[model samples]
Target chain A: MAINTEKNSYTVIFAVVMVVVVGLLLSGISQVLKPNIDANKRAEKQKNILYAMGVNENQGANDVVFVSDDILQEKFDTYITEQFYLQGGEKVDDPEAYLIDIKKEKKKAEDPSYDQKLPLFKGTKDGKDLYVMPVRGKGLWDAIWGFVAVDETMTIQGVFFDHKGETPGLGAEIKQRYFMDDFEGESFLDDGQFEGIAVAKGNNDPKNEDKSDNEVDALAGATITGDGLATMLRKDVQKYVPFFKSLQN
Target chain B: MGLLSRKDANLILDPLADNNPITIQVLGICSALAITAKLVPSVVMAVSVIFVLGVGNVIISLMRNIIPSKIRIIVQLIVVATLVIIVDQVLKAFSYELSKELSVFIGLIITNCIIMGRFEAFALGNGPWKSFLDGIGNALGYGLILVVVGFFRELFGSGTLFGIEIFGNPVEKSGLYAYGYENNGFMVLPPMALIVVGIIIWVQRSRNKDLIEEN
Candidate 1:
């Protein structure tokens, strides 16, 4: 018996049932997979942090290979000596500092009275002490974020940039080796002034030899993404200067 | 041929050439143009579309009879979106790195008209088995064009295929580069994709005169 399918009542009932069914199915799948997805995200964060501090499995000039999963936790534990964050200008030790959400902190800090927790990882690579900081900012299409590892002098040791929805060939190249490698040896301070690096065009130093100038050659077609990255570095890294200065005293 | 009858086989074969979703029908040109810059991404997107369309066709076909005509489009959209999301969540759980690489493209699958086009045009009037075959055929047709376009773009634009240097290193001035050959930077841009697709359509129509419309 074919029920009258053209009835408005049938259409409304079908729509409601479909919505409820789809909602339940999607929510159930998400709930079941939540733990595994969360674990994967945690592992990725650790990998990114480790990658920024120059501890990675990269072999080729263009490779950005992270350490394998089997030894990732071991490597992370061995390399990262201290995990802490600054809240109200006070240092607080946190074992899971890397997992802190920078986006949420940024939103909360907009209240002005809220003291945002700025997570920092201290590690030693090649017997030289390094500090790794996470930064979040805008890109052409969506959010872009990265981890930057710097030494006591605030010179960039290594960086690992990633984006949520940047264009594949253009803005997406920020994560590529050629662009990220240029950040190395670039100092955040110029003669003790906290002057951030700029992704400049026609800086006349395409080879990036003038690290002291606080400028890296910009990507060919990715002007806005490059500027966003430079701004992100300047704004986010500026907050940590006070703590780094206290280290000297 | 051995498994399927002549009529059934045509359902799987017709879209591959004379009635292709991309070339002949011009249904899903948007994604074909957007993600065909590199061979790997093109292949990945093709495989993803194949999965979504094939499964989506079957689901829509199974529900064709009871689906209200007034809200059938919404129901079809829900099916495609649900499938894409499930695939995305599963990939994120098992293969986080690949999920990251396919971040935007996976979401873009729902927007590909081929899935909805197949559902509305064919699956709504067909059985599950035949609809499945049609879905696979159209997706294969789309994939073929994508791979072809990706091949030319990546080779000329980056001097690489699947990220392997086929024309040698452009930066180090090796192999073809040593002979003063330079990568065409324009080929990597989106406009070049349209030109490449246009060239494919021209070549296809020239070979098959029947496809030419009488104006």
Candidate 2:
């Protein structure tokens, strides 16, 4: 009340000082918490990869429980035997391949000259070899991404979908166990030809009993997100067909 | 009651009903509709709003004297943004899963009109303690309406509460579904939320004749 707060000079000075103080505070906090956040992200990635390969602690039908955080490293190490990437038809082993930013790689691969390094995790679950590949795409509201685990025949063993900002109870239901479970036993190849699975509406297979048809029953009120998922599978999963075919030879 | 006087108690209690933020003031209806489709997200949004508003009000009230009236709006905005970011970063670091669930809603908290409305109308003039109480009161009021709306929306819209099936499995045709009852998909949409809020307002006004306005 005593100070002349109405002055333009006073207003400008206050604004500048406030901005500086807030900026410093925010930056300091972010710097200190970066490690923890990064660690959480890494653990989440491991969990998703493992989940896709069906190495989880799910006890109930609807549960999507991942390996616990305490033993996450151990589980990841034991199950994920190798982390590698496919670049220009060559397999390159990379310990940090799982950490590759799919969004950045997708953007860079837009140019014809860039050979995008598609990261894939080779894991052994229940005495069967599984390859988990990460896929990213646009959803109804924002970005949607997931891990798809397939066998040598490119048949889907399992999948784990996640979204950044999809509508809850609608598009967001893509991550639910029921939705993700439908992808199991679905093959990306139809008679030795690449045929990406579709999240089709009116497929009339609500029970998802017909996996060989290359279509899964779509979530109601989530047409755009379902289409996005199908497109994402076609665009990203199609890239690994050569690698799987080489394995067969 | 021992800690606060009747006047101070009113600051924290009045907004819960007579001056409810969503139903009465009509502030922050956007979020009330957006996240209230489910009970879990609605509760989370409410708790986040309570924390941000409480801390924000106190900060604004403390800086009330020095804040230039010309740029006070900008200052308030900065405070809300800063608090929201801090909350978001901390949640990401400590509770990553929860932070993911609340991804967009936390940022949406910055745009909540109730935060700014309180900062301008109450915090700029009131003392810090009073402002904090006011913030808590308004947020609770908003949250009450949100929870009520969310309860109906999730139950009718999805046949569930907090993801727990109340009417058994619709797919299996059990419980209410056996009687040929179907989940009202319209109840999940945003427009339905508006209608639900309108119904609440109508019920409240009818019960208390004092709430009705003569135009």
Candidate 3:
């Protein structure tokens, strides 16, 4: 109490000390959690990769044999045998797939002669080869991304989408399985042409669409997000078409 | 009287009823509306608020004398913000899914008003231990309303508590639900939360005449 409680000197010192203490404490906690957070994120991507490849939590390999959370890492390592990158209709071995930050690489897309190596994951399940690519786009509020899986013939097996800050109960439906299931069995191939899955603004049945094979029902009241999803899928998937076609022979 | 004085006990009890932060004082309603759509998130928010407010109150009270009145709010905010960040980190580490569900609300706890109100009104003038008690009182009061509203909302809206089906899977049990036992989808909306809290205020005020205004 000897220090005057009303002095500018006191306030400045207090502010500095408090900031240093809080900053150090938060940094320390974040440092301790860095490993686990990274692991969780990697595991989540692995899970999505498996999910996109058509592996279910409890319906893969025999009548049961579930791929629970603890086993997702192991399953991913086993199923996804190889990974590589492609740059402008050519296969390459320069960059790894999992490490590519789609959010950043997405920026290079604005450049016409974009030469960034795009990642492609290769896996096999039940004798069927799977090719997967990560896609990113802007949602209503923030970034939206997904893992898209397709077979050698350029048909979508399944997809796993998640968003950073889409409006809950409305635009956030993209993350739900019910909404994602709509993408199941849809193909990027339409009559021997590359056409990515389109998220329609209408919830009309897939059979009712003019291009039923390439369209899925959109979330009601979330047209922007649906359109964004379509744009994200189209632009990102095109990067992997060369690699996928290269493996067909 | 010892530390377990009637007055100190009243600090804990009174807010649970008469001076309730959510229903009575009408503070910290944003979280109540946002997180109450599910019972689990409401409980988590309640526990988090309790920890942050209680610890922040004690920190502020201990520093009350030295805290320049000019920068006390800043100081209080620092304490609350640090505690909230720690809670958020722990949730992310351990309760990852729950953390995802709570999302921005956990960070938003720094602005819950109830915590700041107690720091200014009680912690500034009281002993650290007393302020700690007052903080718990307010947290419990706020949490009580959140839990009640969450319980009702989740029960009727989702036909579940903490995601457990209580009405025997309302969607699939249609043959058994011949009498039309359907989940009230409207109860999940934000306005329904306001109505639930209003009903609580009505019931509490009806039982306690002191809550009624003279006007």
Better of 2 and 3 by TM-score: 3
Interface DockQ of candidate 1: 0.67
lDDT per residue as tens, model 2, B124-184: 9999999999999999999999999999999999999998999988877899999999999
Chain B TM-score for candidate 1: 0.96
TM-scores of chain A across the candidates, in order, are: 0.98, 0.98, 0.87
What lDDT does candidate 1 reach at residue A79? 96
Question: Model 1 segments beyond 4 Å from truth?
Answer: B171-174
Error of 1 at B145 (Å): 1.5
Q: Sort by DockQ, best first.
A: 1, 2, 3
Q: What docking class should model 3 receive?
A: acceptable
RMSD of 3: 3.2
Residue-wise C-alpha lDDT for candidate 3, range B1-215, written one tens digit per residue? 57689999999988998789998889999999999999999999999999998998999899888888898888888888899989988888877767878989999999999999999999999999899999999999999899999999998898789977677655456433556777788899898999999999999889989889897
- Give the winner by DockQ: 2 or 3: 2
lDDT of 1 by residue, A9-85 (tens): 99999999999999999999999999999999999999999999989998767889999999999999999999999
Give per-residue CA lDDT, model 3, range A46-158, as digits (tens). 77777777776643121212256777767878888888877776666633487777766767866878877688888898898888888888888898998888888877777
A59: Cα error in model 2, Å: 4.7
Per-residue lDDT, model 3, residue A236, is 80
